[model samples]
Target: MAWLSPAFPVGGFSYSAGMESAVVEGHVGDGDGVEAWLGVLLAHGGLRNDAILLAEAHRVQGEGQSLEEIISLATALASSAERHAETTRLGEAFVKAAAAWPHPVIDVLVGPVPYGVAVGAVAAAHGVDRVDAIAAFLHAQISQYVSVAIRLGVIGQTRGVSILAASEAPILDAASSYARLDLDDLGSATIIADTLSMRHEIQYSRLFQS
Candidate 1:
């Protein structure tokens, strides 16, 4: 929780994962919309893929394998320029802050690591349960998007909390399934989310980075 929390210094509050764009374009307008949009992501989009990467990273780090391949693949999987920046920037911050735990995996993570890879690798090195790490990571992501929705005037605090409460099943399911799946299963089908993220890159006025 501390690692992926809003106060953890990943600058997560500044990125919406394209939620800002979704709101601006009317793709998401209220609590229901937020829930539905996030549901798609958790099941078939970036969040799903992130879960897979996190699981793989956890496995490799636990086995003391080099993370070069996973790192490269994570970067290459970004759906857009802003998406790329979001993951790498957050990953860098996560690694920097996670160094407080004093794990050798931190030093091994060179260059721009994706957020999932950093979290999974660090957590694995510290002996955090694989399932717990992925589930927490997914929850943090959903919470961030919920925050974005509230800030964008799409939902109030009460509604946002409800949305989070409602997302428990999807988060758990994704985490469970992805933890068992390998790299070959890493894929996203959330076209609208991906396109919104790309459109957010060039959006003339925007509150979030992506």
Candidate 2:
């Protein structure tokens, strides 16, 4: 839980995952919109993609698969430059902090890595259960976006909590579904979210990175 905590220093608070653009476009104007946007993300967008990567990384590490291969695939999966930056920056930070704790598996990762790969590797090295790791990762992603909405004044504190609460079932479902998916099964249908993320790159007066 410490790894996924808001206070973990992953610099996650700086990225809005395209919610800022969505807000500017008026696609997400309130708590309900925030919840709906997150629902789509958790169900079919970056969150789903990350969940699959996390699960596959966890499984591959246990099966003696090459970490380099996983990292390469993950890096390729990033849909945009900002998305790539987000994962790599967060992944690098996570690996640095996790290395201080000295995990034999994670220590072998020499250079930058993707966030999902780093998470799965560290979780496996630390003996965290696959299910728990995926769930926590999804929850952290959801919480980050919700926090973004709150910061944008799209949702109040109580309503943010409520939105998160309402996401519990969907998060579990996505985790469960993604856990059974293989690397080849990876795909995303969140065109709007992806477009917004791309558009965020040139957004003026932006408060978040992406």
Question: Which one wins on lDDT?
Answer: 1
* TM-score (C-alpha) between model 2 and the true structure: 0.97
lDDT of 2 by residue, 72-104 (tens): 999988898999999999998888877767867
On the 0 to 100 scale, the lDDT of residue 21 in model 1 is: 89
Q: lDDT of each model, Cα atoms only?
A: 0.92, 0.88
Q: Which tens-of-lDDT digit does each residue in 51-153 have in candidate 1?
A: 8999999999999899999999999999999999999999999999998888778889877999999999999999999999999999999999999999999
Q: Give the TM-score of candidate 1.
A: 0.98
Candidate 2 displacement at residue 117 in angstroms:
1.0
Clashes of each: 1, 1
The number of the candidate with the highest TM-score is: 1
Model 2 residue 136 CA deviation in Å: 0.3
